[model samples]
Target: MIHVLFVCTGNTCRSPMAAALFNHWAEVMGMSSRVRAGSAGMAALGGEAASEHAVKAMARRGINLAHHRARPVEEAIPKADLVLCMGHGQAQLLRERYPRFAERIHPLMPYAWGLRTDVEDPYGGDLETYEAVAEKLEETVQSVLQKLENSRET
Candidate 1:
């Protein structure tokens, strides 16, 4: 299986949501067995539940985040086939910290959607902020899964 890791500042908001969305979409696209997802935070304290707004936003899309916990990037990166970061700074930090895995690290927007912006963090924001981030993540993760499928085909 191909393991993809999504990274952000705190696993509570963006990364976990992205992983949940990716896993859901992958199963829907019949690629769940081949591609799996995980999430971590560059600065997480570990074991913290996802943000309240994040959980509600995910529930709106029929996805669950109540059981999600925050984890540090160090615990997830080594096993990932691809390390997609929510921001360019996070990607660069991982690349520098794990030079051997530098080639596997990239910003999600640029690599998946060909955009140059960071996936916004909605940590302390309202439900609308989390919803917007989820929408963007949904589109990007689907695009990334398609790219992964194409790469495997080739």
Candidate 2:
């Protein structure tokens, strides 16, 4: 199994969004049995649930974030084949903190869609902002699935 870990400032938002979206992508591509995903935070309030807006946003896509609980970044790397971070800063931090895993750490958006940008945090944002973030995540996830699927065909 290839395990992917999504990282963000707090596990309440972006990372969980990426994890949930990745799982959906895995299902759509029939790779659910091989590719698995989870999320963690750089500075986390462990055990806290995902943000309300995040939960609702995922609900719109028929994904569930309700069971998500915050975890710290330190506990993530060892189990992950790839560690995707929400922002460049977070990716940098992971590389600095876990230098041995540097090659496996990358910014989620750029790694997913060749877009060198962060998945902006929407923790305190309104529902519309969460909706927009969800859309962006879905697009990125779809792009990643296409890339991986195409690669497998070759």
* Each candidate's clash count: 0, 0
* Count of clashing pairs, candidate 1: 0
- The segments of candidate 1 whose C-alpha lies over 4 angstroms from its true place after superposition are none
Residue-wise C-alpha lDDT for candidate 1, range 98-148, written one tens digit per residue: 999999999999999788999989988988888899999999999999999
Pick the TM-score winner: 1
Give candidate 2's whole-model lDDT. Answer: 0.89
Clashes in model 2: which pairs? none
Pick the lDDT winner.
1
Q: Would you give me the overall lDDT of model 1? A: 0.94
* Tens-digit per-residue lDDT, 45-108, candidate 2: 8899999999999999999889999999888879998898989999998899999999999998
Output the lDDT of residue 127, model 2: 98
Q: What overall lDDT goes with each candidate model?
A: 0.94, 0.89
